[model samples]
Target: MELEGDLFSLTNLRNMEIIDINTGAKLGFIKDLKINCEEHKIISIILPSQTFKISLFGKNEDIEIPWDNVKKIGVDVILVDGKNLVEE
Candidate 1:
């Protein structure tokens, strides 16, 4: 049951928190979206890196979750199927 016909605004999406269904961990909120302009579809949703800014790489990396991995988009949260996606 995809949201094929439902209309959604970016603001509405930004307000919803993202959660990983598999691990039941709060991933983060949407910082941006990866959209396919030609196809007029969303490719993925971007989020701030869970790690600190002082990570080994010296900078935090953004997290990109493929649209296909999204299991459901509820009124308050977007559930994603990320198995072993985050530990701790």
Candidate 2:
């Protein structure tokens, strides 16, 4: 399915898994997605539970994975560049 349609169809996207391309490791579930309403482009992905301490400290670091880093969108997961996650 197309990316936009796949994303919108998901009801509870916050719990959907996201994968790291290089290591094939599950990064985390998506907490939220940043989208540009005017351009209708995805800006970043927010993984709220990746770091427990950060979440506790009231700093939910949303890993801003640019649209270019997205490898694919599956039925229940989003694939992204592992290098980008590591670099952050």
Using TM-score as the measure, the top candidate is 1
Report the lDDT tens digits of candidate 2 across residue range 12-49. 55656888888988888776677999997777776654
Q: Model 1, range 1-88, lDDT digits (tens) per residue?
A: 2453377789999998999988889998999898999999898888888877555867567788888888888878889987634221
Give all TM-scores, in the order shown: 0.81, 0.69
lDDT of 1: 0.80
- What are the Cα lDDT values of the candidates? 0.80, 0.67
In terms of lDDT, the best-performing candidate is 1
Clash counts per candidate, in order, are 0, 0
